[model samples]
Target: MNGHADVGPLTSLDLRLQWRAAATADLADWAALIARTAAVERPVWFERRADLEQILASKKNPAAANTILGFDPEGVARACGRITRNPEGEKAIGFGCVDPGWQGSGIGTGLLGWMEARTRQRFAADADAGADGGSGAAPRLRLHMEQQHTHQAALFGDAGNRIVRYFNEMHRPLQDGFPEAVLDGGLELVTFGPRLHEPVQLAHNEAFRDHWGSEPRNEEGWGFVVNDPLARPDLSAVVVERASGRVADYQLASHDAGSAESRGYAEGYTDLLGVQREFRGRGVAQALLADAMRRFAAAGMDKASLDVDSETPTGALALYAKMGYVAVSTSMVWDKDL
Candidate 1:
């Protein structure tokens, strides 16, 4: 039986399902279980549990009002997920995996249902105290999925949600090398700072404006960048408008040396590649990208990688395609109203 309508024999199954707020004690096992599972399943893009712990450490505190839940019984945590409030006042849910032996069981649905209910309860209680005003309605939840993972997609549809958007992961190999070009249109390429934090951040936010699925950057969003395990403050690049002295484009580069795929491979990643709205047709992005490739190549890297919204309004996917990146893998984002 689906966990939503009834808790079945699986509910009373051998493994007990318990819930608790994430704590220091469970951190290690939590990461291990997730890392091992991801390694076996989606090895290429799996995030180590240590990565989650670091994010949690930065977000958790006594004064903060947010929920990060853990589902586990005894020493094993077969599944994990989170519900967070973004700066835009939106509450979101991100969940993944069930112990292989327990796959057919109701644990996955149970955890998600519990999360939805818990979110409503918390938001409702806050509204009662006059913090948000009116009845506390549950916020919507969203998650990412592999485009080919239809079983997981159906699971959400069965629970009364709908697919929202498709997120694509695009890649390119620097091993094939980059194309050289002479500057045209009188535009100049410049590397501002390993020091201009505020400028780069502002330029990034401006560049992303009007793009599909784009959200404003704030302290919370910036937290994701600043605390990212792959975030290398020194390797970031921003393109400046020589005439106006304004940053018209920017890109952030970083690598995952710990990845098993990178054990002996010479590869780096072009993350957060963005070009400003007014600067689109000017070749600013390509210039910055070419410069970034040169930098990574100079650092002795064989390839560079990045992910793009195949449906981005700016036609970024085609831009990357023309620039020599190829589609290596794909993932989609699914969402439902709560």
Candidate 2:
């Protein structure tokens, strides 16, 4: 995609603001910016170009304006960010980073302001078109930042955002044997496959309905996960009810051995885990997790990781702790009403 027609000037930092829809060509620069920013903020964080590419591809609507890039006078990328609106158009998710060398130079703040403005303008137009189906309520702007990154938290806080929720990145070593998949009668454990996508998607939406700030997953969002190159369909687990033959719970696993952010470790990430409301009391959730962990171990992964809402109503944090997972990092979701 081409850069936005109007290239605004950021005279203070000798940088020009360019609003652009991200393309495959920008993956390398985006990955580099993510790596550099992570190194300076959270050294353990790792991002891959392929991951970014998959996300951009999932947007599907090529005409949607969602990305902004800032460049130095020398044509070098100095900062970048993107805004993603939920299918319901009630929320906008944003994230961006400034070059390590350019921190404290107002570049990061300027980029955030630009993104927020863009989000507001887009949502305003959608509102005028009755895009929200006549809700007429203003959309909320949301952004996530590592709790340890006080500077980022401060920057957003200064802009009137408040911490709305916290999430923990939990990890567990796989050297120990994983628990055997234990399922109650009439529940069968199976691997993810083509026919199970829709059922799994519906179950996921139902499971996350009570989650903070959760939006139902649309077709494009579901496609993004299943179509990801790194997604291990064979390694992912799905628990189905025998009577109705429907997916009750699922665990989607992914791994990229070549990811520089992984720090050379063979890590299997449980991208999404969900259990339908009716299946909560049963052992379906635990069974799906155990089967996933077993698959990761069979793949010779050194560890497994996943993120959970710290205040999940399902007591997920406590459940994970009981399963030998420990918090490795913490992040907060900040929100501002638009």
Clashing pairs in 1: none
**Candidate 2: which pairs clash?**
46-261
Candidate 2 Cα errors over 4 Å, as ranges: 1-3, 6-21, 43-47, 58-64, 87-89, 259-264
Please give the TM-score that candidate 2 achieves against the real structure.
Answer: 0.90
**Candidate 2 per-residue C-alpha lDDT over 157-253 given as tens digits, one digit per residue, 9 for 90 to 100:** 9989999898999988899778765798888888899999999999889888988877788898888788877899988988888999988889999
Q: What's each prediction's TM-score? A: 0.81, 0.90
Q: In model 1, where is the ten-residue run with the lowest total lDDT?
A: 1-10
Deviation of model 2 at 249, angstroms: 0.7
Superposed model 1: Cα runs more than 4 Å off: 1-15, 58-74, 89-91, 121-138, 181-194, 260-266
Whole-structure CA lDDT of model 1: 0.63
Pick the TM-score winner: 2
